[model samples]
Target: MMCFRQVTLSLILLLLGQATPSRLQSLGATKLRLVGPGSRPEEGRLEVLHNGQWGTVCDDNFALQEATVACRQLGFESALTWAHSAKYGQGEGPIWLDNVRCVGTESSLDQCSSNGWGISDCSHSEDIGVVCHPQRQRGYVSERVSNALGPQGRRLEEVRLKPILASAKRRNPVTEGAVEVKYEGQWRQVCDQGWTMNNSRVVCGMLGFPSQQPINSHYYRKVWNLKMKDPKSRLNSLTKKNSFWVHRVTCLGTEPHMASCQVQVSPARGKLRPACPGGMHAVVSCVPGPRFRPQKAKPPRRKDSWAQQEPKVRLRSGAQVGEGRIEVLMHHQWGTVCDHRWDLISASVVCRQLGFGSAREALFGAQLGQGLGPIHLSEVRCRGYERTLSDCRALEGSQNGCQHENDAAVRCNVPSMGFQNQVRLAGGRRPEEGVVEVQVEVNGIRRWGAVCSDHWGLTEAMVACRQLGLGFASHAIKDTWYWQGTPGAGEVVLSGVRCSGTELALQQCQRHGPVHCSHGAGRFSAGVSCTDSAPDLVMNAQLVQETAYLEDRPLSQLYCAHEENCLSKSADLMDWPYGYRRLLRFSSQIYNLGRADFRPKTGRHSWIWHQCHMHYHSIEVFTHYDLLTVNGSKVAEGHKASFCLEDTNCPTGLQRRYACANFGEQGVTVGCWDTYRHDIDCQWVDITDVGPGDYIFQVVVNPKFEVAESDFSNNMMQCRCKYDGHRVWLHNCHTGDSYRANAELSLEQEQRLRNNLI
Candidate 1:
């Protein structure tokens, strides 16, 4: 058997000098033994004769496949047939056959071991043994013959194997056509036509050396020279830094060899040629073969002209189709039409588009406007036209601009009217003042009057007055009988007639008859008797002023007038005694008494006044003093103090008066004086024994701050001490007049003092 054959081979190998202890170790031989092929046989199991003994493979799941794999491992092809359990004989050793599957390509017998050996269960009881025979080697002689071929047949020309060695001397020596480069698995010459120090540096870089190191070391230059194969290939002459020929020549450029161009070599005694001088010129040519020109590229074809393309338009559902149906243009390929359906009726839109005036008319067939570009319209429904552009699809390909010289046109009309007239009320009084009388005359006749008051409760008066068919009176008759004793009175009268109770037109009544009117006490008449008895006991007549007569009036009436008028009066009125001399003089001489008459014949009297006085160095400043009456008053003897008083009552009328004054040296002037009532007139007289300085005085009036002047400028006044001897000085009068007393210390000054202390 297989063991006997292996023993014979082992004996034969022992006789030869090639067999050593290592060879014996690899074969696992203690001593050689002889056995026959059929001495032991097992199906689906592997047997090995090792150390002169036979062993089994425990095949728990061993079969023909595993046996074939074991046979092939012993250099046999595969199992010729399947063998069952103990078909040859049960081996004395443990059966290791278990779970074995193989593709029959294993390399050794012992490689086919299965599960743990020698168990009793039949599935685990099967064992494997091999009947292996020696395999003969093929192609052995051919292998020997192949190995006999010399290193020259296996030599690699693609890579250069020689190391570049440096010589001890000879710097910048000429190497004429002496260098070759390995390229494309071949040694090729490098042209030197345009070689330069830069090219030398590039070569030095390819060799992994610094550019300056190669240029400064003579050893490097010698090493480069040794690296060259041919020493006479024309790389000899080159010098000078700026020489044009010093640049490297490249395979892609004018020259293909290093020696084809001149190059500069360093003259330094110890410097080396830094690099191969042709690297910069060694670019691979893109052209085919060795030619330099690149092949010409092909051009693209032109696309079809837009006019020749088919006309197409896209439409959305629900879009109206008529003479104004949406249409697209086929120029430069078809595209959606923009909605430009416009005409005289809708020319406002066209006018907006062309930034023109309003559209006057729509012209077709080039009458008003011409259609130039492709008509792009959508949702266009022109009722004025006959044919829908979209329906006339064939027209899109026509020569006459889509078969229509005029796609659409519009005429615009410009507006001619200017701003119109409007009525604006310039001035009027409120209705609560018993029918505010207003006169509006376009030519010269009164047009409107007795308008309602801006506030409530008074509109009823206006309505009742108008209901009586009476025109507004020419002027306001305040306190007239018409308004007297009436809570909600509105009426018209004829004669002896107070407008306070009548609602009849002036022309409807007798000029001298008793006036018929309405009253706030409930509608009634002057001559007509009331069928119902008057209240047994009338409440005390509530004479509420419907309109504010003065600033001190009720709060509700205060705001009844225009806000500006009320504010002006409130602002200008100052704290001062009323019915003072200056105020009396002011009212007497300046106010228009004729216009202020409350009754037809009785004139209004001036009763209000405001006064203030002070003294400084014989200078008596009297504000609100009446100058018009001062000249007639007698002067007391002791240093008669006098002055030309200037009135400061603002919106109220003003008047001036001259009063002579006298005082002693050191200015025996009174600084202050109390305003007192003199025969129902208030006045401020000089007081003695008062010294010069700053002082404040306040006077209390029955109704302090009552404003008479409603004009904004004249309503308010303020008083302050003036060193200039004026009674009223407006600015900064409260603080003392010492400049140094309020000077603020600077930070730097304080800091300097602190440093000085330190």
Candidate 2:
């Protein structure tokens, strides 16, 4: 009776417990969940709720202090240990935090300092996790979080740009690669369906690049087909068996990551299937910005006997540090290397020894001025893998027939930060034509400095034009003294710049060294006149066949033609009427199909005065006409040298704006044509000497390749011709590459002609 009464009193006291929540639960912080392959609730990868979704924290800077806070938040008494490198298992979704810092006294992990939500430079291998103590409060219970808040969809983990061949890794990093995406703890490929520049931009951005570039998938496919032992195998190894994880990704090209774009996964087809029926997988090419370089290891010192040789290399007389005669310190005496077998590979070793990039130009013949010392070494042969000039194989003495005048010189790439973005152009009539300037930061002070004008040429201007996105360079000027009042007048910062015309930026060009110009020399800085586009001169294919005829002229009328070699060589030896010479005449219409004017590269100072045309002609030899056998043997040729290039006629909706009289502007303007009529003096392919059966008439424009054009392929036109001593007929005339579909027909016709059956 007494125990029953006490139990009743205890039940009454228990029912009167405090109505307020416990202080632990009263913090108003959301609880974190332990998730992964681990079965126990106390162990697994740690995850927290953010933006109504779950994300993992990067284990970059995680430790026991942060793990203690994580354990307490998950209702554990303390954290026993922290798991790094995804010890439990890799987590999906976003990596919420990185480089996290926390004190053990923190009540929750949220109170710690981190790299902010969903931002990390970590891979899945750096996932943070924690193992908590096996004890909990008596009344506490673990509850599994429901997936209703966020869908159980897979998140993109990593983006890998797989190259077609492992050997091509050093050639181009982003231009040639098969794109792969990571999902569901496995790396999978994306189908090429609807894969446009927009999709590529997003992927490139996710890979930390600025923009997308075009990839030559066809070229890669051709190369891959040649490499594959069994190409007919239905699976594409480039796409990794077409195991696509995502398809139909739509992006406006503004997304920072692929996840931010609107994605449709297996909408038209199922996963692990061929989403692209063409059997081609998705490929992404990115234009890497300035910061997209891999972190390179420091160059290691050699461990061999030659390692003790100190104070080894130096450059001399170069305006820049890297542009100099390569000299070696041997027995405390500075001596130069001979130019025998001296190449870029040998020069690159010298450049690297001076703490610079590869050699831009390996100059010989004392190009950087003669070194006063003895030529110490000769026949230096390097595979371009050596770290220093001493590592290369060479003759020890002057036995290799070397001299001081044959000293090797090198121009090395500039080693400077902010080189790409700090460059600018100023001091020209147009923004595209200007003096080059760069912002120099010295002791934390910023000021604009000019590039020295010495040795400035078109090759250096090509790099500057490409870096500015202004297309090819028209003219590279060595001095801007004429434009003295321009805004680019400043102190000189760079000198002795030499470029190969292939670099994407001027900074990639080889330089002498640092900014070491005499004061006020920047006023006459280097300048360039850049053209947005260059002309592409193509021959008119239809006109060649339409104007085909045989011209037999008398001796008096053939005087001009004979002098210019428009007629055959037999005409000079033959009687009057040139023995009824069979001349194959044709009209050549050269069209300017590019955006800018097709001007000769030479300036007014170089223009040749033509007495016959009574005009100063910029180009002396513009076109060549030839008649050849089907076996590629030339029977006769006609050369047209002088041309008054002008826009006599234009395409629809365009005007003939340029003329030779102005002299201010030259070249065939865009949308215009300079026509050399069939009746012109030298427009005939002289077939007068032979009894022509079947022939191929070819016309080549810009034959010398003197001026730079956008393309050179379209400059030639060929046609099938038949001549029987008196009359000639032309058919199947076409420009380069346009007649590929009819190649079989031409081959069959040639076979018939060879058998005398045509």
Candidate 3:
């Protein structure tokens, strides 16, 4: 009947054309189900195929919430509502239903449900089956499982199941050997046929032998040949073994459990021996020590013996021939002394050799020459008292390879005391041959003249007199009147001069001269006289006092007088209160001094007013005018004086008051003048607002002179007058006539007048 049943079943399957079994039916073993906290959808299905059969859970009280939880357990994304009436397809097996409800917190469907079966409100048509599709798989667990099993088997089992022997082929089935090991706490035999000496050595090293040490004497050839039987045989063989013991053995050299000097046995068959003695014939494993060779030592360095030689001296400056130190240029190269031994004594020797005064400093480092060679000379010793080059140990007259350009630099100082005597005067009497008579012209007129003799020649004496501020006399006479010689014979002849000698030569004098002269005995006397015809002497004048005022008030004042005028008979002309005045027509008798009357008597000349006097705090003088000689007599006429009143006594009343001069108008007017008791008491009228014209500033010098009521002529008092602030001559004026007169003002003067008015 069983056979008939099998035949019918097979035929039925064939008639149905079902050649292959269904996937669900192919799973005939128990399947593993994955349910965890981190599971999510899309990974597909919680249960995997084992012994094939499909079953459904009975979700008796199942709700959408419970279905969502089951879906999550099956590795789905957040669930939709549960499908009640077989929304997918009808399942073939019995449905498992029970009390089921799930909060979202459940780790698995079984944990969330009240019963073992998945209970929900699902009919048999809608069986509670699962589809797990987690978002990611735990790959670490898979890796660990694979590592534990390995590709062939566990790494430990490769040797633990059988003993490894040197004679066994790598591809052959392994057998137990005499060597044993404790792996995972169990004694095992090494697979002898598959293991090599290298593998044995690795195993032995893991058993605690220093693998880097020498192992040339430790390995036995006979022990490695022991044949491996079963695990029991390996144990029996180890019972009488007397070699080292190890816990583990490996065929691979990298195995960490291998011992360097240990015995192993197969654990698949039996236990190992309890007490194995040493030195017995057993299969001991070991790792050979690493090979190493020691390196040899080197010899010491040689000492430099050339540096111990005695000292020598080398170079000197300005020496003739070979009197200097010996300098050796080695290998076409130059060097200098280190200066370590250079001192004053050595320097003195070098100076004497060079024919210089003395040695101030010994310069090193090629200061004056190109130090191009090896430095052979080191220490130099010398006493400064050595007189000559040969008397010292300064390497004199020694032949050297040094070139002239490669000599070390040296410098010396020459004494200044030797040059003093050579520059002095020769007999000191002043030579008499080089006398020169200088004739000077100033403003086209001679102002100085003189004769010089001996070393006090005309040129030198003129220079000396000019230095003394005394110009040579005009018209130098070389006849018996002034000199015994003819003109320019033995004495110098000069003419037409005017000078105030203040220069190194008469040519530097500033005025015309040659007017008069005198003579004396032994001294060869000469005298200077004012040439009344010379323009320089005729126009001689100077400022006595200069004062400045601000706001019509005097600020500060000064007095200047020529030094020559302070020392002569004309010094009395500087006395105060002197008065002088003149008036003439515009076309009067003016004289132009002729050229012959102003010839140069000496090299140079100057003219100066011998004295200066200040009266009424101001004075007026004309700079541009011809000197007039009326009726062939010398006199000044038709001149104007431009001047300003400046004194410390002027009243300072207001900020706008000021004193100024209009030079273009040939006149001046005092503005913002402060009236004082003295000015009013003297009947000096305030003319601040007077129009442009000619007027006189009168002052009553004598108190007795007074205006009378009866006589018009007696009412007016005439006084000696001086014009102030740019003056012009008035041709006509009477004793009683009003002084006012019409006059034209220049453009510059007009502008100034307008500014003062504003």
Top candidate (TM-score): 2
Candidate 1 TM-score over all chains jointly: 0.14
lDDT of 3 by residue, 676-724 (tens): 2211111112112222343332211111211001111211212112234
Off by over 4 Å in 2: 1-201, 205-464, 476-528, 565-581, 601-616, 659-667, 739-758
RMSD values, in order shown: 52.4, 28.5, 54.1
lDDT tens readout by residue for model 1, 234-321: 3232212211111233221111112211223222234434344433112210101101011342221222111123223321110011
Off by over 4 Å in 1: 1-45, 49-53, 58-60, 109-113, 116-758
Q: Give per-model TM-scores.
A: 0.14, 0.38, 0.16
Q: What is the alpha-carbon lDDT for the whole of candidate 2?
A: 0.62
For model 2, the run of ten residues with the poorest summed lDDT:
1-10
On lDDT, who's better, 1 or 2?
A: 2
Error of 3 at 271 (Å): 21
Error of 3 at 159 (Å): 10
Query: What's the CA error at residue 60 for candidate 1, in Å?
Result: 4.1
